[model samples]
Structure formats: structure tokens, C-alpha cells
Target chain A: MNAANSGSDMPAWLVIERVVRSHWSLSARGERDAGAVLLALWADDRRDLGEGFLLRAAYLGASRLRVIELALDEAAPAFPSLVEIYPGAVRMECAVRDVLGVQADSADSRAWLRHAGWPVDYLPLRHDADRSARFAAQAEDYAFVRVEGDGVHEIAVGPVHAGTIEPGHFRFSVVGEKVLRLEQRLGYVHKGIEQRFSQMDLQQGQRLAARVSGDTAVAYSWAYCMALEQLCGTRVPARAQQLRAVLLERERIANHLGDLGALGNDAGFGFGLTQFSLLKERLLRANAEVYGARYPMDGIVPGGVATNLSSQQIERLREQGMVLEAAVVELRAIYDEHAGVQDRFVTTGRMSPELAQRLGVVGLAARASGSPRDLRSDLALAPYAGLGVQAAGSAQGDVAARVAVRFDEVIESLRLCDLLLQDLAGGAIHAELGAAAAQQLGIGLVEGWRGPVMIALEATVDGRIRRCHPHDPSWQNWPALEHAIIGNIVPDFPLINKSFNLSYSGQDL
Target chain B: MLDILKRIARTGIVSEPQLKLADLLSERDTLHAEIAGILGRALAIRQVDAGSCNGCELEINALNNPIYNIEGAGIRFVASPRHADLLLVTGPVAKNMEIALKRTYDATPEPKYVVAVGDCGCTGGIFGESYASCGRVSNVIPVDAEVSGCPPAPTAILRGILSALASPRR
Candidate 1:
């Protein structure tokens, strides 16, 4: 078994000692206190573990995953909600209740994923939850918050959109064109991915992970594979690490380019869209030529990547990188100087740094809002550790801020791609990853283009995946989108939505 | 802004090589003539993502990009299903999304066609008939044309769109 140093280089504050792990095996009250102390001390993020309904929290300072087994067999499964400490835990708490039947004593628990499809008592992710049962379609009136005043009205948009985007219902409480409140309901695309993971072998689970969000396929697959490799004690080759980094950076550049164009289009700049879209198409075609998939789906597997690149392909990629950089820099100037775009973007959908902190906004959105937390730099995992990554950020946290962040990231990623290709080492791109040990827990966090994409894997004795929870940065950023639009006019909704561009499928899974 | 205009002038007509229907249609003899006759110079499409990974949606979106230049081919996506001539459905119809997909299919006028894009849409790719998923697009509604790829290329999706237009009316 290849144990390439089990996260030993993490900072001292980030380390959760073995004693802390055992401390969580406590009475419900003790668990609540422990969670409070963890949040107060260092924990920055929360994730719902599908196995045993375990609630896991992690830190960006030092790479540590603290699991609080909420459902102890001896007692009734209940724990004081972490919402008091980490307000971000509210959604995770509701999702855990909806999926795993573990209750968090939070004020708002109106069934997150239930979505009028599942019965009140039915928990989809529970081991004993009957799979054969069919749910007849029904529409339950979602209790959207009311804004009653003179000229106040409510506008409901989508589960089916006019654009070629995914499904998510958005309710806007508006006083004329100005948005008073914005509440979004997601989970229309929930395909039971967590339960599906248990049925597949470890390698198949990697494929499933990539599909969690197609745009961030490399991020999800890499996170999943990283978790599995750590669990099986497999050391990925240096060449594989280099290739994975290349793919990841490519994915980042591609998504950011597309988004930058869309954001431009949203702000009524068709010239920016056409120019940026042309540049982005070149990148996609280049990706298809080099990686064999436009989006890098299934390119990353359990042990390592699926394919190796020849030096000629590397040269082509480097050339494309140069072209893309020039085009983006040219377009960035256009975006900045254009009065129409600036007028719409400058203060529209403003989110203050303090509000971002309070809401626990994450990923690119968080970084744009003066939160300089980046997993690549903060958690310094391999390839990234060797090649120092500077986090791109802005203080504004508006549509302009997000756009600026994307442009900065695109340029940085292109530079990284060139470096990765130049520094490509010679070796096998894949390692032989064997069966995972029984009852093992593995966690992987990757800084995807949008933000941090995290995956927690648990394997059974027979090497089958016990449970896999692929968490997207969208989980944290989606609520920030709602908050970002509080004061913006209704017409500016599309522009704001495009700027953030949170994934419905990623969040739904 | 002046720089952008100058750049556009310098690189006159930077659009990628246009996709000819003849070359694409020659590969499939089934609906080549019929689709061309029916579609003429315009086809209004409405995209319904039943439960895709958004891979197919990205590719479908790519169809509208400058290089693919689908608009030049006289195909455009409409906001409303009622205004659509074809329904381009992607993803492995999830149980939750089944009714919505059907409602969309039913909402479209009688002469409309449904083209299932992506392997998932065609045959429920990886996440197959499970408790939460209803498998392929055909499982929920009749699919006239099946474009098979994990997420088919933009050219292939366009072909699927054409084939569905040419498909026999039920």
C-alpha cells in the first residue's frame, strides 16, 4: 500500500488529533458541544456523510476532516444544529434530514430534497429505504416568503427555462422592478447519485463522480479519485499528477472563458460574447483534440488519468494557451471600458465582505467578495504544492467583481497550463489502485474553477463503494446568489445569475 | 472599444468553417431530403434537460456559438415550447422530471418533433433505470431521433435536430 504521507504537512491548527475523533463518539449533548467548539476553534465547512448519517466538517487552514457520527445506535439520532455557530450548516442540516433521516434541531427544516415527490417519512439515502417504491407526481405550494406593501408583487421563474440552462425554480418578491427578496428552490435534477454510488465498484464510482457536474468533471473526478487513492493507499505517478493538473487548469480556463462570454452577453455586450465565445470554442476543440473529451469527462480515474499526451499535443496546447491569453486580455479591456456593461455591473447585486462572511459564501464568488480562500493555495495538494498558485480575488463582490475574478483566473490558468506542460515528467500516467480497506473513510478537496469541489468516499469490505458524497462549491455559493440579488432589479436577474452561474445538477446531487 | 473594432477589422470574417448539411446528411440517407424540405430555412427549437449532467446542455449551447454558427443554418432556439418546431431533449429522464418532460412534449403543437440528444437521453447512459431515474427519453415520451454520444458533438446534435424534423408524423 502506497501511503504518500497522509496529509502530514497540514498546519498545526488544521490537524484534528485522534483524541478528537474518539471524542465525537459521545452522547448527543457531548457531540453538540464538540461541534460548537470545532466551529469556534477552526472548522470552516460542513458536509453530510451518507454513511451512518455522519456529519463531517473541514478546515482550509490545515486539511482536516472531522466526522461527528450523529446517529449513534445506542440513542435516538438527534444533535443540536451547528447553525448557531456556522450559519452555512443550515442547508447541509436540512439536506441531511431529507436524505439520511438524521435530524438537526434547526429552526427551518421544511424538507430540502423532498420536493413534493417523496413522502414526509421517507428518507431516500437510508440503507433500508425501499428502492422499488414509486412516487406519484404532486405539486406542493412552496411557502415562499411574502412581501406585502404598496406595489409589491411576486414573480416566479422556472423549473423550465427559456434558455438552454438546467432546471431550478426562482421566486422573486419584487416592489416594481426592484427585488425585495429572492428565494430559489433546487433539486429538480436529483438522480439519486449517492445511492447509485453504492451499487458501483470503486472505478465505476469515478465515472459517476465526473457526471455530478459536467463542466467541473475533472474537479469531481480528481476529488473522487484522490479520496479513493488515499483510501487504497495508492500513490499516483508524478506524470499522472502533472497531467491531472493540466486537465484541471484546462477545465478552469474553458469554463471561465464560457462564463466570461455569457456574462458579457448578459450585460448586453454582444461583441464581447462573440469574441470570447470564438476564443472559448478554440479551447474546446483543442481539448477535444488533446484530452479526447471536450469537458474532460472520465479522463480522470481512480488511480490516475485515462490517457497520456504526446509532446506534439502538449505543443499545440501551449500554442492555444498563448492565443487564448491574448484574446482574453484584449476582451477584458473591452469589458472594462464599455459603459453599458460597467453601468449594469458596477454596483448591481452587491455583496459586502461582512455579508459574505456571515453567509459563508464560497469558491470564486467568495474570493470575488474579499474572501481570499482558495483550496489550491490553502490546502496545497500535489501539483499545486509544487507549483505555487496565487488566489485571484476582488473586494467588490458584484457582477463586475465576479467577471474580473474570472478574467484573472483564465489568464492565471493559461499560465499554469504552459508551466505544467513544460514541467511534464516521464513515467506511467496511471497506478495500480487495489481494493480499499473495509470501513475506511477518505476525503478529497480540489479547487475547481468555480470553487472547491469536495468528495467523501467510504468503501465496504468487498471493495464496493459504500457511499460517496460529491459536494460542489455551488452548495455554498447558491444561497449567495439569492442574497446578491436582494436589491437588484428583476431585469438584472439573468445577468447576476450568469455572473455566479451556480450549477443546479451539482447542487442537486 | 476602438481596439476591439480594429481587431475585428484586421481579422476580417473570423468565423470557423461553416457546417454543410449535405456532408452531414450524406452520412445518413434516411431523412436527408425530407428534413430539408420540411425545415426549409428555419427551425425553432426548445431544449428540455430532463436530468442531464449539463454536459449535453453545454454542447447544445455550443451549437449557437460563432464557430458552429447554428443560426446560419437557419436553426434557432425559442423560449416557449408552443413556438418551437422541434424539442431537443437531453439527459436520462429522472423520476422527478418525468411529468415536466411530458408536459413540455404535450405543450408543443402537433407537428413538433422530439430529438433525444446524448447517450443518456438515447439509452440512459450511465445512471440507468434506477429508483430515481426513468432511464431514456423514450421511456417518458416517444423519441423520434437518437443522437448517441456521452454528450454528442454540436454537429451531431444539429443532425439529430434535422432527423427529428424529417421524422414521420405520428
Candidate 2:
């Protein structure tokens, strides 16, 4: 679709035009923003990677005809801080500063990178670090949002948690059971992933993307491969595309199963946990049997899938899927009918539809908040478009609504998986992706288990990746967590947080 | 009684021992083997997330599910300076997770072995390091054995653990 006429569905494009008023080459581009068209441009190179491009939208309130030069340099690019214009861009700009070495020349350039357990001298995204240099051990005082009141206390939870979960420090300023302010201190699990990419080949890099978050393997892998393919101008075989859809659907269902169970368990319903856990186990086992991996990683390569599913495997998948569906239906009825569970989840952690829209929360959480922005449908790509998939959403913006959205998505994914299997095409699984042409930039967007994952790939001469920026939905949604838990009780944080299970690692990257 | 029976029916059956002696004997043997496995060798495991997208962590938590029972294997994830005999970390360690990767390695107690479970942990199985990633676990952390597949079936993770325990580096 053409950029001007593409309506909300138009692909994001970067267009350079010369302003008649100024000699500078004005760079203007369109990005999909909450079902609307938003333009972002900047005049500096050093701030480009960190501020202009990194921050979703930075509005400069100067002359309308001011010439803007689009900066796409590997080392550094400059962009004006929109924190003054659009306060929402603050966290995003800070994130860019942490990973990418591009420092935001904004007013608030405090000790963002040196917080928690991150090494100070090293910037993970920069390519200058030596491979053998031992990461220096440094500990700096972490600054958290302070709150003072009568009978109010603060609880500092660990970067090393009680469970086997990743390290993230949660500081809650609370009065008895009511939480006044909750500030998150993450980066404890920060590994120099982006920096290490310079030292590895494309294949190795793809592995890292998939592991960004373990659950959303298909989404991250596909997003990475899509970026790679776009850079090299490779066409994935139709069969491979279909297989990818199947893998993605499988991942969606598996995650839903686990989430459903966990949500239930969180509300003191052990039966739901046991039943859903059992269902999840069966599904994972089937996944392992068919895809050789339970979570289905390495399934999507640059040009196509690394492996193919056989007829027998497909049949087995169908059978297991059917059984799981039946169990889900049965278990869901039990959950829906349970009064105590329903009461706990119904309106416990409510993020009003209006607030959700303003914050731009995506995935199931967004859907629950009445934002119907599904990349699969709204930004339809490949097999999903062909299949005529319908995106599901809710407007309640509550924990129960989130749970319901997940359930609806699980059912929809099951249907999609069945259709994909039935219409499985026979063809070569892969196409040879030749080296990327120099200075080629490609954008990849895929709906992950959590939400839409956006990846931008820039290649250098000889096909080496110059810069890659994979934006997880969590980047936008993590802040929403801070907002969602505002009025809720301190104990309900887990329930609310679980509803929108944003990945700290995914966001940090 | 009828209500209880009906509720039981809704869930599933409650299994009773068919042969108490045989059950006792099997349980004893299983316990004996588990203890023996723990005593036989000190296992060093390094977790590499080939690419898991963390759904596996839920199940990994369930490994200590108090039922399927992981600790009974005498397996524990260690975090400190050279105390970990096994390195059990997760993730396709994203680009940001790279330094943590080296630190995890540096902290491992000597003669440490690595077991990369989950697909992402193995070969950067899925989320190959994109612009946001360093790619695979092996890229940052030195790996000994790879438990391939996206979050290798917990059974696979178990098998990988067993294999790591069996093979000790001199």
C-alpha cells in the first residue's frame, strides 16, 4: 500500500523532503500510533539513535518549516528531547541511553545505567567493547521514587527474588495494605547482549533474540528473522510462513494455558492451577514431540523455518489440541462459575479503557482495555491476512477482562492452528538469503505471545548488521504497570502484574 | 457424600495404591537412586536460554512444584563467587543480559559445568540476537552441554541435568 493512501494500515515509511524555507533535508516518517498516523523527525545525528528514533514521538515546538535531517548513523545520532513536548518519551529515551551508548542530552541524565548491578563503563549496545575484558563489578546507590507520609512504609523486594524469576527490584511505598507509589529497579539481569551481537554471525544473533524472553520464543525469533530477511530481501517460502503461523499459534496457546492456570492460582484456586498446568504440560509435551522443542525455538530461520512438520506430526498436534480445547472449555466453565475467583478478578486491577489508550498498552492487556490494535489483524502480515483472522478485544480493562481476553485468544489461536494445519502447503521450507545490500534498512513487526514486537534492522557493507533495534511491547506497557497498580491494594499487585506479564529483559533490550 | 463424589468426578479420580508393598518398594528404590545420584558426583550446570520467549520459567518453578520434585535431585541453582557447581541461568540472554552472562560464569564455583536448557538457551534457538540481543547463551557464557529446543521439555531439562552430572570435566 502507498504511504499516503494506506490509511491506518499503511506500512511505516521514512521519506526525506527538502523544506523550501531551509537548506536542511527534512526527514519525515509515518508510524502506526493507537490507530492513528504520527510523525517523528529530528535534526541531530548523535541523538538520533537515542532520542529521535528511539523515542516514539518527539515534537519540536519551533518553526514549522525548520529543516530536519534524519540521522541513521551506527555510532551516534542526535534528536531533540521530546520529554518537554511529549512527557511519555522520557522512559523510552532513558532505555535507549541504557542499552545504546547514545546519550539523551535531556535535563534528566542521572545515573540511569549505573543503577542496580549494571557495569558503568560498558554500554551493552555499543560495538567498542573488547570480547575478553572482564565485566567490572560496581555497585551504586539506586534512586527510587520517594514517598513520605504518616504510617507509610517502604518494602524493597530483590533483584534476586524468592522464585526462579529474573531479578528486578520493586520498591513499594505503602501505608499498611494500600500502596502509594511503586517504583521498579531492574537491569540486575542485564547481560551485554547487544554488544555481543557484533562478535557473532546472524544465526547466533537470531538465537539471542528468541531468548530475550523464554516464553515468547516464536515472536522474538520470527521478528529477528523477519528483520534479517527484510535486510537481505529474502522471501520466506509460503509453507515456511504457514509453519511459522502454526508455531506462533502453538506458543500463544501454550502461554495462555500457563497464564490461565497462574491467574487462577493467584486467586487461591489451586484446581485451576492443577488443571491448567496439566493441560499446559500436555500441550508442551506435544510441542516437544512434534517440534523437537517444547517452546518451539529455532523453528524460524532467516529465509524460512529450520525444520518442517510432517503429516503425522500435524495429526498428533491436532489430536492433542482438540483434547486441550475440551479441557479448557471444561475448566473455563468452572472458573467462570466460581464466585470467589470471579470476585477477586472482576475489577481488582482496572486500567480504564481511556487510560490504556493514552498509555498505548498492547497485546492482551490492551485488548482488555478496549484497544483493538492486534498486529495480526490491524497490521496483517502473511498467512494471518490470508486466513482472515479476526482480532478479539475487551473494554472492561480489568484483571478478569484480561483473563477473558487471553481465553478468547487461546480459542481463536486453536481455530487458526487447525485451519493452518488443514491448509498446509507443500513447498521448500527455506530460501537462501544472500548477503544484505549495503545501507539497507528494514522494519519487521510481529504479534508475539505478549504483544506486537517491532524490529528495525540496518545493515553495513558486506551484509554485517550495523544496528538492530527490537522494541518489545513491554517498553510501552511496563510504565502502564506503574499506572495500573495505582489505587489497588498492595497484595493485588501480583494479580494485576500477572495479567500484563511484561518482560523486564525484553523491555531492557 | 454425593456432592463430594460429584466434585471429585468433575476434577478426576483419586488413585489408591493397588499394591502397597510394590509401591513402597518402588518409592524406596527411587529415593535411593536420587540420593545416590546426588552423592555420586557434584553437577555443574550453566543455563543458556537458546531462545525461550520465559513460559518455561513457570514450569521451571514447578520443578520445585513440591510434587514433580526437583530439589530431591539435590540440584540447586547457586548465585555467588565460585560456589555454583552448576550454572542454571535462563533466557536467549538478551543483549542487555550479556554482562550478567559473564558474571554468572565468573561466579561459578570451580569445575563448573553448564546445561543450556530451552531452545533459546541452546543455540539462540529462536530469538537470535536481534538489534536488542547478544543472541545465544554460549556467546557470553561458556557452555558445556546444550539442552536444545525452546525451553526443552522439562523432561529434557532433567535429562540434560542428568547428563551434565554424568560427564565431569577432569
Candidate 3:
């Protein structure tokens, strides 16, 4: 389709454009808006500018992305919350409120990311945020919205969960086994990662990014480095990009294997857990042997990847890939054929396509609900573009659909891994980055195992990071669980949750 | 069911033997007996993630895989701290999770052990002493043993648990 047809297809963007234009016309417009246009970002030496906070919102279309920026006056920082357009923005709006002290012009003004860790006035991301201040113990209990009525009881599930999982509290209002409402109290894992980013040099910041969510380490680090490289105008070698793809694809497979097993275990099938976990273990061992780190948290660096492979190493990986693909295919057939497992998974945690689009759920969860917009295919970047990565999709938006998408993606990723190994470009694995050019705003978006991991970097003229916002697609997904769990029994929550598998730290940051 | 049985038959048992000294650190068999003897049953561990990147938790979970078969070694991760003999904690204690972690610790019966898992748990790793962080796991609760790696591998984590159980409290 041409630009005109695509433009007409976008209702949300058209509405946002109209809203921005009206706001521009209502107020005394600045020189920035020639004809009520979307404000161009990183303009006019933003590095040296006064304390004006930037509000950035990215709308990813079928083949295009529109990033809208509104420069709010720092003194009275408030913007119209996108919660109306994207209900997922409510928690994020609260995060901005707690972290940067930015007010969202919305009714729901609950605190997020700040569990009374700091005083209200002491926003950690403010220009004058002090590093030495200490706060006393939090005195108040979070007032979760109570579900009122007779026979309606509440079950509080955790900040520290039952298993070896990340911490997040879930409040389930249920009458017997049927869930009435599910209110999630996340940000229990907030470690001041965004605040920590501001203190690092551009080169040192990627380490923190990698830790944003441990499972998606490769994606976060790559995105962070991608942004930094963009700012510094560094050229990553073709070999490095290919190695990065290998690591990225491996990370995806590892996570999928783990989750698939967990989903089975949650559904009461121990055999599924045993087989998938074994496969996952084998993959992790290969990672440790090849990359020198089981998780490879530091594998992807600023200009390129951390490690290079020899031709023999490439051949070894190729042989391993074939074995994994065959085993995964075998397992997929078993999952599809198992009547007991299929009965439990088929209709559990069903989120309608309408609800998914309305709530702005992205990534694999979005794909399960029929959108199927994978960044690898959507953005069509180097290795992914050439490898012809197929976007795995389904319309059921149930646990079964999510499982199918994962299985399909793993098969596709295995195929890509083989192709990537066959076509290795020989060169330096990393490039030394030069001084970052002043007044550049670097943005990097990579398709992580969970979803799209995005990093927005702003560095000082001297190369220290000024402000960085690392966003996880979990922010777009976690809320969907609340809706999906409404009709399901309390026992199925774990299966539904693992199917979505949204990262707690990704959003908690 | 038949396919599952066949797969299990093919996969056999990848879990380490009872006396795989080289697999774990020194004194693997003795530590296992000590743990099983101490509890007189399975050693129930309750894992508490204070504010980790969840990388450490990944390794902790890896201990459950058939290759590690942490359960076969007479240890199982229980849901409730009240039912636990040990607390496996990960991450630098986020200020928000401080009270929750503390509550979890208090809920566990006395003579309970807490093994700090991961570099973040031991020394706060990269996120040391931040405005929102309390640094190490010790900052929130008493830790008996420490596992220090970006995220200590499953074997290292298993070794840390053995050390924590075999040795006395700090």
C-alpha cells in the first residue's frame, strides 16, 4: 500500500495528530510547529538546553513507526496521558510520575515504581536528584482497589512468589474458583536501573541495560549499544551483526524452551517439563561453552558483539542446531497429540483480539492475538531482513495459541541460526567507538524474546549519559493478564501467566 | 503418555550420581547426606528475589532441570517460607522489597539458613548502594553463605547451598 492508504488505515495516529494540532492552536504555538506538525526531536543542541522534559510516544504501524515528542515545561511538567488511547500507559504514566516527577493529566494518580522508597518531592530522575539522600521506612500499605460484595473474597499472592520467579504481587478477587478481578501490584523489582543509567558513561551504560531484565540480556544490551552506536556514528562490522543475531536467536530459543516447560508443569504434565527443561539445559550448556558465559550478559557491546567465533566453532554450532531442531519438532508433536495437556491449554486465559488491540498488548502475546507484528519482519533490519524471519502468529489468544506461536518461532529461529552460520562475514568482532556527537538523541528498538526492548539515550557533550529510558514490551502486556484471568479459575493463573511471561524487571525499571 | 514414557526412557536420568565429587565442589556426597539428615526429609528451600535482574533466579530455576535434578539431591523449593529450611535469596535488596523480604525471613522458623545467590546478592554487583537499593542481601537479612558470579551457574549455586547447609551460621 502507498503512504495515503496506510495513513488512512491509522485511526489512532490520526486522532493523536488532531489532538496535538488542537492543543497547538489552543495555546500560543512556538516556532517548532510550522503547521501543527509532530515536533522534530533532538533539535537545537538539546544537550545544552534548559530543563525542559521530553515526552516521547512511539506508535508502531504495520510498516512504519511514528514517534511523537512533546516538550513539557519543566516547572509544571504534565502531559495528556495516553491511557485513553492505550490503557497500558496507566502504569507507565505512574512510573514517569514516580521516577521523573512528571504528572500525567489523568484521573488514576496512583504511585508506581516508587513503593514509598523515596519521598514524593525527591524524584530520582530530576536534574537536581541527589545521590546521597536517604529515606526512612515506608509507613503506608498500598491501597489496592477492593472488590466489594458478599461471598467475594480476596487472595493476595506475592512480592516474593511460590517458585524461583521474579517478585510481583497479584490481588485476586474471587467467588469460589471464578476470578472477579485481578489487580497486579508490580514494580517490586525496581532497582533504580533508569536512575543508574544517568550516572554511567555512554559506553558503560549498556551493562546496566543488559541487566534490565536478565532473560532478555542480549536484546537489551544490543539495543543500548545500537543507540550508542547511532549517537557516536560508529560502523559495526558485518561479522559482528551476524554473531549478534546468533546470540539473539539463541536467547529466544532458550527462553521459549523454559516457558514451554513451565506452561506444561503448570498444567500438571510433569513429562513435558522434564523433556523441555532437558532441551533448555543442553542449549544453555552450548551457550556457556561457546560464549564463556551461560547467560552471556555482556556478549553484545557498544559497537558490536563481545566474542568472535572460529570456523570450527561455527561448524560445531551448526551440528548442534540440527539436533535441537529435530528434538523440538518431536516435542511439538507430543504436545499437540497429548489429550490431557491439550484440554487444559486450549481455552485457558483467553484474551480476545479486541481486548488485545484496545489494551495495546505487543510482542508474542500480541502475535497470539492475531496482530503478528514482529519487529524482525516489521523493521526488516540487516540479518533478520536477509534471513527472512517468519512472524509466527495465531488468533486464539489462548494458552494453546501462545504455545503454538512459541513452537513455530523456535523452528523458524533454528532455520535462521543455520543460515546465519553458513554465511559468516569474517572481520573484527567489535569497533572502538569515537566521541559521541553533541545534541544527538539515540533510539534503539530490538525484538527481544519477551517483546521489543527499546532504549532512548541522551548523552552529554562529554559522553556521559544524561537521561535514558529503557522500555520493555512487558509494560504493554502485564495489564492484559488482568483481563485474561477474569473468567479463568484461580488454579489456571500460573499457566496463563507463564504463557504471557511478561518480565517484572523490564517494567519495574 | 506412551510418547512421554519413550522420551523419558531415551533421556534416562541426567542427574548427577550420589558421589559425583567432581561435579559439585569438594565433599558433594557428605553435604547431601548432611542436608537429608538435618531435615530428616527433603530440604525445603524458599527462594526470595529481593530485586534481581531475574538472571540469578534463572540459574536457581536451572537447578530444577533434570540435568541438575535439585530434587533428586534431597532439596525442593517450597512455596511458603514457613515450610522452608533455607531461604535462597537473589539480587541487591531493592528498598521496596525490603519489608517483604524481611517478612519472608521472619515467617520462616528459627535455625533457618539464608544463602545469598549471585554477585548482586553478595556485593550488590553493578547496582551497589543505590538510592533505591540496600546493596547486598545481608543488608536486608542475615546470610550464611554467598554465591558470587554475574549469576553463579547451577552447579555453583548447588555448591553454595551445600556449603550453607554443611557449615554453621555466620
Give the candidate number with the greatest lDDT.
Answer: 3
Candidate 1's TM-score on the B chain = 0.87
C-alpha RMSD of candidate 3: 5.1
Ranking by lDDT: 3, 1, 2
Q: Candidate 1 vs candidate 3: which has greater lDDT?
A: 3
Best by DockQ: 3
Deviation of model 3 at A56, angstroms: 1.5
lDDT per residue (tens digit) for residues B28-145 in model 2: 3464465356556433333433223455575575553333444444555543435556666566665434554566567666666676766567665444544334556677667667
Q: Which 10 residues in a row give candidate 3 chain A its minimum summed lDDT? A: A36-45
**TM-score-best of 2 and 3:** 3
Better of 2 and 3 by DockQ: 3
Error of 3 at A456 (Å): 0.4
lDDT of 3 by residue, A155-214 (tens): 999988888899999999999999999999988888888778878888889899999999
> Could you give candidate 1's per-residue lDDT for residues B1-170 as a string of tens digits?
67878878865665444554556645433443454666553678999999999999989988888877767656789998988888999888877788788889999986778999998998888888766788899988988999999778888887777767666777
> Per-residue lDDT of A133-194 in model 1, one digit per residue for the tens?
66766676777778899999988887889899998889999998899999888888888888
Give me the candidate number with maximum TM-score: 3
